[model samples]
Target chain A: GQQVQQSPASLVLQEGENAELQCNFSSTATRLQWFYQRPGGSLVSLLSNPSGTKHTGRLTSTTVTKERRGSLHISSSQITDSGTYLCAMSNNNAPRFGAGTKLSVKP
Target chain B: ETAVFQTPNYHVTQVGNEVSFNCKQTLGHDTMYWYKQDSKKLLKIMFSYNNKQLIVNETVPRRFSPQSSDKAHLNLRIKSVEPEDSAVYLCASSPDWGSQNTLYFGAGTRLSVL
Candidate 1:
């Protein structure tokens, strides 16, 4: 069983559209973080939300620990934002990662 | 803006050969980790160290080992590589070893085993 699960394995959208990504954990998560990875590039941290909603620029993340789920909302998407979005959770001292949502934004 | 650094952006070797990858963090973090991403792009944690002490070791093969000389450096070594070992090895670091901390990752080292 996967400890972390992400919805919409892949998404394609036009520029300026809004995109929503979901993450669900099978167990209790003490921390949650969202990351973005361009093709053949390193993972970049987007947001770290433990339990509440946090915002940064065009990205907004909301995590509800009690439900073991988190979401990343991207507003006004751009072609540069086209990449894989991964959500990771921490349970105890171990880290669990989701399969990730591959998003493509067309200009 | 790159805090985590990894050596040998790419490596291709034959099976049964030894391979090593290096990782360093300049963020003054106390916790570092090594993750493996397979061809399917599935990422999984292999080892984690906090202040040069092993904290987590996943069910990896015996040939795989992680070495950390200090809090800033953590290295991965495979005694005898296999075809299944071909994957992107990523290195990460966090300021502390807690559930609430965020991890910074390095440009992964792509390994290809023949």
Candidate 2:
């Protein structure tokens, strides 16, 4: 079975600080995506990078397919950024998710 | 912008009860999926339908079933729910069966089985 593992299960940072999240998959993946979810809210796709690096807004994601690992970096964190960051990967079927990293940006 | 919609944001029922959750996607995606999020926020894929056809059915209990009337609509029905069934049911849609497309998720329906 395929598995996705995320690091730093929880993170807390100041408003102006930075945050980095890590994800590793057990097997090869054709697609990798990062998602954000507020408490009791829906999952919002942040970035989808199967390989190399990609950026959007204050978030950046880097994926190394051969290594089966990825990372999400958040810069200039804001209080509203407090939520959960999820990493999902798929080979040829439905995507499977990691346990998710709970992030809290303090004032 | 919230193209996927799920009905009954929250549901509360007792053991041995049956419940159904409805999901619709306006994104015109050809594939829809049902995922379960436990209290620990561990997500697992339960079912997937592509163009109104059952494509991927995980090792879910036989009491759980999925219905797809069209490519845009997929529903989940759970019979004789148990305490372990209390979790959030998320509906998502992608453009196709492959991994090239990104998923659009709904708000999800929270179920409480007591």
Candidate 3:
């Protein structure tokens, strides 16, 4: 069973638009991570924000540990961002993953 | 920048054959993990190793074995390939065992069993 849940299993956005992805967990997580994967490609670590806000490039990740919720905001969506955004959490040694948010950017 | 490397970006083998996938981490992280992605785009954790101890997901078959020679390398060995094993195997490493540690992942090895 999946312990982590990510909303909008699939999303499509126009070029230059903004997009937000949500991740919620069923259990308290000691650490939460966000990753991006291109179709039939490798995964790139986007951020590791457990209970705070973090930013890199055009991506911003915010996490609220108490609420077991996290969000990723993408500014100026591009075709390169069209892929799967995966959310994973770890508590102790066991790690769990959400299905993922598939994003498609239209030009 | 730290990197995790997985060999055999793509592999095809016949059923009953043995195959092995290798993983290496140059980040010198203490934790490494193996995840499997099905055709449905669902990713599931297969195994996790922290220096010494190995944690295996209960759903994984007995034919799937994970071997770690050291802290920087973790390898997956399949005793007998099966059609059901055809999927993507991703290798990832973390700086620590903590939940907040960022995971650096390799591109992945796509396996196809005929």
Candidate 4:
């Protein structure tokens, strides 16, 4: 009963390239959050876009609440940006997570 | 710059042993949570507390319990360690239970059970 699903379990790209990650949920989400997890590290919140679109630095997050879907775009990817991107959504109090998309940026 | 603090970056113990992990947040958040990340990279919420009151308790084992003395601190205690319990435990907090706030996470404590 996974509520959140992320596509392309893993991704690889050259430096300076752009990457697009998708997140789909089974039900309406009142809150959507994107997180980044480095190897053997913790998760850092990247974006918290429940609806519409939002941007921060080279990252962009768009969520369609009605459609129960969200997307995270990473522009000009760098080697340091290599990590696992996780998408979480909450309809109420507790948040649910997807398997995540692991991104590797090669220089 | 460390808003959320988790002690014992790594811990190793034998099966049947008891373990406790501590978490504290300085962001003055009203809600705190405990999440577990398995080796397969699956993150799941275990429990959540708001204002020192238990809010959300997922279908975790009864051996796992969340203890909170205040809104700023949330601790996790396991009565008996098991091999399946070896994973990274993350602590997170948000300003409140409202949808307007984003969660801030700690570095996590990696546990290894033999």
- The DockQ of predicted model 4 stands at 0.79
Query: lDDT ranking from best to worst?
Result: 2, 1, 4, 3
Worst 10 residues of 2 chain B by lDDT: B95-104
Count the clashes in each prediction.
0, 0, 1, 0
lDDT of each: 0.94, 0.96, 0.88, 0.93
Could you tell which candidate, 1 or 3, scores higher by TM-score? Answer: 1
Predicted candidate 3 versus true structure: per-residue lDDT over B23-94, tens digit per residue? 999997989999999997787889888884685454789999999999899999999998999999999988
Candidate 1 vs candidate 3: the DockQ winner is 1
Q: List fnat per candidate, in order.
A: 0.77, 0.98, 0.79, 0.74
Candidate 4, residues A14-42, lDDT tens digits: the string is 99999999999998899899999999888
Evaluate residue A85 in candidate 1 and report its C-alpha lDDT on the 0 to 100 scale.
97
lDDT of 2 at B27: 91
Q: In candidate 4, which residue pairs clash?
A: none
Q: lDDT value for candidate 3?
A: 0.88
The parts of candidate 2 lying over 4 Å away from their true place are none
By TM-score: ranked, best first? 2, 1, 4, 3
Model 1 chain B scores worst on lDDT over the 10 consecutive residues at B94-103
Identify the candidate with maximal DockQ: 2
Pairs of residues clashing in candidate 1: none
Q: What's the TM for model 2?
A: 0.99
User: Which of 1 and 2 is the better model by DockQ?
Assistant: 2
